[model samples]
Target: MMHEPIKGNPLPSRAQAYKTVAVIGAGSWGTALAATLARAGVSTRIWGRDESVIEEINAHHTSEKFLPDVTLPDNLMGVRELSGALAGAEAALIVVPSRSIRSVARQVAEYAPDGMPVAICAKGIEAETGYLMTQVAEEELGNRPVGCVSGPTFAREAALGHLTAATVAFTFSQADRLKPHESPAVRLAVSLSTESFRAYVSDDLVGVEIGGAVKNVIAIACGMMTGAGFAENTRAALITRGLDELKALAEALGGRRETVTGLSGVGDLTLTCSSTTSRNMALGMQLGQGIPRDNCFDGKPVVVEGEVNAKSVTDLARRLNVDMPICETVRAILHDGKGVGDGFAQLWARPIEAEPRAMDLSFDHPASDKDIATLAERIS
Candidate 1:
């Protein structure tokens, strides 16, 4: 069921005023979001490079290549011309591949209306520059408000109108500018939320983006465990420990630790790791089943973001001096041709330490010293 905005707390005139949105990229994720906005009664245009995909979406209200068996909203149109997609768009969503973010942002910069808000829906660190999706957008968009929308969202489920939640992280300034008669942040939040899709606003852009990116790598590790015949106990251990690594990297990158504990963090991690529907997990499953990397993704149009993210995350972790054993192991297996058995053996060979390493809790907590002592005693 779609959630109605709080009854008495109606949105201001301007907050409820947006009429159209442009979605760049015609992949499953992009199409799903476009369908969502169109269902919300907003005119949505999706830009795709392929003429066939555009024709399929326009003529049949479906993108069979990316989102099969799903009927899109009639209000949703697909455009082959980038300029046409952005011509009258009130806001834009960039849903391209991580590496293509810069080029797409440059196009939006040239074609989009001045000062239009852009939300990045892609999640990954740039392999060459280590830039997060929003960072790349800001660099190329030049003063345009760039935010991020991320969580544990599967395109198929979202397109089917299943309940979904996502975090929208934007700067205070961006939030302020987006506001009309009320709180800008709240107004921006209202603009994005739909009956079935809920948007939570946060200022921790780095944490949200990091969680979305790094969880794919961890999901691959969990898939490897599944393929190796490890039980749920092993998967549980990886999820817990992987979260610790996620928190460490988020903090090192100047994000609040609590952000990793939210929807975009543990929520996304759990979904991706536990589901074979995840492209990354499926790719890892192939590797675990002894399939070569080249053969793993044969004839697939969707990108398995984790395969590239493994290298990027490991590189970022090293640059920040954060310990990420699992991510590093994934990097070795994917990029260095390390055997799966050897990778797990290497991880098991490492010396044991405190469950939550002391360094992992470097961030100051709100608990009183007495509270900490009580918690410690309970654990002991």
Candidate 2:
């Protein structure tokens, strides 16, 4: 489905939303988003299995382990029980690790209010099933409305209330859209946005999810370049070529190519690849510095999603017959026991070709200016 603009009532003021939201993880990203919602006057509850973390959040209003030095809002609380978190939530955001998405979503489907919109904030392909985050959500969450929230967000910066914009992709069922009810997509966008956090709504769920998943693998490659003391030009080339790989895979999976050029695709890719704060990039950096894979994430509390996603994406590309050399190289370095240097050598050994059109190319004839204008009008 195409990403049509959200059409419905103009959202009420932030103070008037009066929403209570459930965030299904107490990790850095989940906590940060919970804080954002609470600061926007929405009552927010974060769920976690760790009692100590829940206690710290409720009593001290801080997540010292994941987001140290960040103060949470008064209205943001933490719950040890998932049921307690979902009891009165108008919506739920699944922010757990990508690998745990299916399990968490099943629990949410069991407890969350009927018809509650669930926003998937996690970003990775399931290593075991190769399912995108949204696909997993759909399989486990049943008929619940599903959306994806992703972009160039750093948890610390977002918690600090720095201006951040993210792509929010949701689609209404045809039956729901034909009814007299307001657009759930619009409502989700309004409920999730804060003064400093903006959401650009889209209907390209596949593109949004693919962008969020594949960028991590590319970030690992970029980090390897950085750790190997490569110049900025090399990093820039990787970023560009990495985007090409992303576009190709996303399109092959039935996603719109233009969606990849949006916030969830190039935007997230640039952020993850350019920063040491990205856990995936950091993992790659450690590998480049001669650290073994087992020891790379030794003291880190957070999961390095790219390490697992590297193998998943490579598998997916192979299944789809998509060319993703960067992701393949990442998979080799992380999973195939290939040395970082050797992986780079393999990538450099590939033959060159003209840049392939990553968008849909089923047209049989060239288009005139009038045809181009008509196409633009239709898309616009």
Candidate 3:
């Protein structure tokens, strides 16, 4: 849900706002953001390692490699060097893959100005450390104000200048400590918002990030059902049940269940699960259609995050003793060599049970200090 307008100091005018914004990662998502920011009149620079992509974006104002046929704004610059992207930029958006977040953030720390606000646009749990994208950013960019942007956004649609709404959750812990308009979330939201792209601000950073990360795994399950030619009602039931699992896991991680129903959770889940545009869903669909697991990524260029996230999300759920059968099943199929058909059968074979009560989904014990500290740490 979009947040109510909070009373505080007014935001700076666009003319007075940050003039230039750096968007790290020139993939589809990153390119889309750079285009949006440039269209919004913010001089935007997108950084990537792809020589052809950089040339296309700079010479032709297009990212043909990722966002084919979409014309980018003339003001949007593409840079091959990290320093060229971050140098003198007021804010940065890290849109790299989940696994590369820590490395990208480390580079940003070395190049970006001190105290520059950075927004994490990646969605996945770190397979090695089980850290959210924002957590990885925070640890690496220690002095930077880290935030997260998530929702049901598709790179292609957004790049095409289609309407899009997203949640921007900041790291602020106390609403009473800072005025609403003065908050990091609000500032970043303003920096990214445009007429076509709307950003809703929230303080529930953990909830927002958790919702985005776990939903991809669920999307895979939904895709499998679709590939198997299941009925609409069956898919709907899976989505609803999958949401309960998401809520339980979020609550266990010191996040709110309500966030599960918000944009990052149900909203993202709906968009990802129902469409072939989502790489995760497409992967699941292929598996459901009897494609060999080993041949799934035969020619894919980019990483399908759900394949990696399935294991990480399930592992985290297990550590917290959270029941996430759907996600676990996905993890098994994707990682443990479990057949897709067998996985689906196991899910259906489970005994029917009563739907969980609201209280059942709620966290029984509050998040302890130790738990919070552990969450902050990166496992070696």
Candidate 4:
């Protein structure tokens, strides 16, 4: 296990200072990641579409909304123009909210050096395109090496250097497509065995991504439980049902079943649900406590992935015949005028069958009754 040595200069010699790692967006999470790279000795350059934020980092070294009180590293530079940040960067990490993925990807493609690896840390689907951020990355940044970063990291916590772990998703068919690069920080690096933080790499990009997108909706349900004063039993049910929906989606796309059980899967979901800090979960709790769903995120000013993804996921589940009971209920509560209590009542009233009926819609089989029965028995 080779660890990055501690000193005035860290990072391996072969691992040249992210020779300018560009991050699009200057929010709390974006700032935290940029700070991480800077601390890792990677001369990180952050792009702020808003000149004021760039000026703030350049002048004050603190973001009032995101990372206040902690001064940003002196090595960190924030550029007002997108091209300035992307011009010579070997790699770029997109940390803009999921809804803004396409716009930022296009900017990078237009501004960055040719074929740079644009790693996407924004986790969500394009509600209009029905495409994950990676899909948008391929379309927007043609020929760019694409990778994804996701896990149970909260912006403030990761910034404070609390231990955390995440899976890095790289796009390519062959295993060699996912190897270590002396430059550009390639290959998925994991700090496993640490109590607080770590990461694991996987080829199951599709499963890991879709689960990351959909889990927010489920996490909101858990938040509703906390806000509504529900018992732990209620919260456990949401987590269990949420995992079922995630595994079903993972199987639908070509992801290894085991992948959904890992960090980007069940691990991420549990973190978001059990805690009140997650914006998405917090949004749901507010809604359950009688706040308008719109008011739940009224002033946040960034796309909450769950706010955009829940409907998209529910639509996908319906078309694919995947029975995502909890997801469907959450969608209804948000959009269909169904009160949280009413939604729970409906879920509890549904005819109780074995749990396998929840996620085994193997799009491979016939949807007919006899075929369904056979598939059900086989899965059971």
- For each candidate, the alpha-carbon lDDT, in order, equals 0.83, 0.82, 0.82, 0.74
Candidate 2 vs candidate 4: which has greater TM-score?
Answer: 2
- Name the top lDDT candidate: 1
88-205: candidate 4 lDDT, tens digit per residue: 8878888888877888788788887886777788877776767777888889999877878888888888777788778877744433332234423243242111334455666567
Between the candidate structures 2 and 4, which one is better when assessed by lDDT?
A: 2
lDDT of 3 at 339: 72
Select the stronger candidate by lDDT from 1 and 2.
1
Q: TM-score, each model?
A: 0.87, 0.87, 0.88, 0.84
The true-versus-predicted C-alpha distance at residue 227 of model 3, in Å, is: 1.1
Tens-digit lDDT string for candidate 2 (1-380): 44343477443333234378889999899999888888877788899888899999999999899899999988888898999999988888899888888988988888988878899999888877778898899899887888889999999999998999888788756653443134555555666678899977677888898999899999999888777767688689888999998888888888888989999999999999999899878887777777776777775565788888898888888989988989998888788877777677556545545565534433333545565455433322
The total of clashing pairs for model 1 equals 2
User: Native-vs-model 2 lDDT?
Assistant: 0.82
lDDT of 3 by residue, 1-380 (tens): 34444467554433234678999999999999888888888889999988788998889998777888998898888898999999999889999899899988998999999988899999988877878889888999988889888999999899898999899888674552345666667766776788899988777888899888888999899887787777688679888988888888888888877777899989998899888899888888888877776677675564788889899999888889888889988988888987776676666655555585543343234555465344323110
- RMSD (CA, Å), candidate 2 to true, equals 9.5
> Which 10-residue span in candidate 4 carries the lowest summed lDDT?
185-194
lDDT of 4 at 114: 81
RMSD for all candidates, in order, please.
8.5, 9.5, 8.7, 8.3
Error of 1 at 244 (Å): 0.7
